[model samples]
Target: MGFQLTADGFAKTIDALKEHYLIYAPVLKKGTGRFTDTDIVRYDFVNEASEIELERKSDYAFKEFLTPLSETLLFFTEDQVKAADIPDKPVLIFLRSCDLHAVRRQDDMYLNNGWTPDWFFKRRRDLVKFVLIGCKKSYQNCFCVSMGSNRSEDGYVFSVETDGDGFACDVPDTGFVPFFAAGQAADIKPSYVTKNDFEVRVPDQVPGAILKHALWDEYSSRCIGCGRCNYVCPTCTCYTMQDIFYHENGKVGERRRVAAACMVDGFTNVAGGGEYRKSQGERMRYRVLHKISDHKKRFGENMCIGCGRCDDACPEYISYSNILNKVTDAVENLGKEVQ
Candidate 1:
């Protein structure tokens, strides 16, 4: 069902939903941007309709609610171990079409990649639902059209977009229909970006020789190994475990699963002081290939949903989309060399 709601009606609807679901949406955070005196739009819990930043593309992805940057998996004592408690309240996350597609990538990694689903991730995933935030226009650095993630027809309870002085919603899930009962019924379809400012061409296959390609060397000098890209990427799921011990006792502590980035140093560190992919170039190569090529080999689809948060987060201004094109060019060049 579709509905056309007045601003007040929408606010009331949000108010009613709050009674049951923990709503999260993009919020304008003042003075919290990378630059001084700037604002950034990122995901945060919202209690009302007015709190959601609907005009801008979120600087961060909604993946944090599902796969937090730092999550306590379990608490441990000298002789006892207990899993950390998760909140029983269900969650509702508002996100765009690209991010909706990114959720599939996340599901493939945590729920389907291995023999057993991650218990911690599954618990959170089960409690969560999605709300599609319709994209009226393409944002800067976005290539969702090329990635085929600019439109999401399903996977959300409802789809919402700004309409005049109010909102238009397509409530596919019958369970949520009553929330918008006050609104006027209408035939509403969520808006989607049909095109982006630019396009990215991912090669069908990336050859092994591309690993030694000169394209990666540029990133070695240009990239400072900040790892901001991995942090912002909705699909990057790498994590490292930490055993946090109390100062008074060593055995009693909590084991945390902290987000990890392959671009950063010490990520490859192992026993006996050994480290793999020592250079930033090698790290860059690994990350790029994994996004465009390696992941598809395993999951039958590219991991990158092309939301371009990595481009937005990179302090060094390295363009991941450009790197993907470079990889494509290198693949073509390698084909010529083989011929």
Candidate 2:
């Protein structure tokens, strides 16, 4: 088991982790309108307390470190084939509990379910470290409490907090962290949530003749075809490929992976000029059901960590909770009628 780290001890853990791994935390970028107010991952440099934003979750998630927006699966020339040189460096990412749950769900799909989890994620999983910070209070649209993901635990290599004077540190593992000034550990009084606290009432049997429910139609209408929900979600894994030819040297070009979304209009389009989910409503239904219904049937739990990012990122103001809970209740009512 990992040791309990106080605020200062946690900082020392970060310093130690950075020695071998590339440390990435949320960094704010400013510029033109198109690029302004975005979170970009960068080398961990400053240990300044001012730069830490543990009070609120980052606008972007840490999944990008493992599954990048653009990735070259395999490159090919005229005849012979060779793997592209994507860095396999282990990357240490600072994340909240909701984000950590998202990672667990992703691992169920990619590694256990065979999407082939990236070494960047796996290596980091083995060697990378975590510096978890407990949320003192809830942030905007944060439904972590509702989803039972509001707290941190010993899974982290280090944990931190602020008291009146300085900080406290714990190295549960076997390492030294020096990022924080040493002080007495504060007694944490964080809130906790349980599995049965606020469940979505997933059916014991789903996607087994219940796929064509009317709830799909209603949920689809509120969808504006925006992909913001996917962007903010930690477990929504969809991506598209891109190939750009340099004007100067067309012979040397790399294929990249760009993030894809189910809500996007053309998301389901394929080679035969056929669209898998042509209608906006169909796309929305696909995403929500995939999270709560389909994913649960295969895996033990719903893929959604219930971060409420879908509700937060929606331009059309669609609430995933309202839609999913309504569907569950509707299905229950339908079952009673059948009986």
Candidate 2 local lDDT, 205-319, one digit each (tens): 5544456676677655677787888987889877777876544555555566688998888888889898898777678778877887778878877777766666766767787
List per-prediction Cα lDDT, in the order shown: 0.92, 0.63
Consecutive 10-residue window with the lowest summed lDDT within model 1: 243-252
Top-scoring candidate (TM-score): 1
Question: Candidate 1 vs. truth: CA RMSD?
Answer: 1.0
- Please provide, for model 1 over 133-242, each residue's C-alpha lDDT reduced to its tens digit, 9 standing for 90 to 100: 98899999999999989998899999889999999999999999999977999998999988889799999988889988999999879999989999989999999999
- Residue 82 local lDDT, model 2: 58
Alpha-carbon runs more than 4 Å astray in model 1: 247-249
For model 1, the local distance difference test gives 0.92
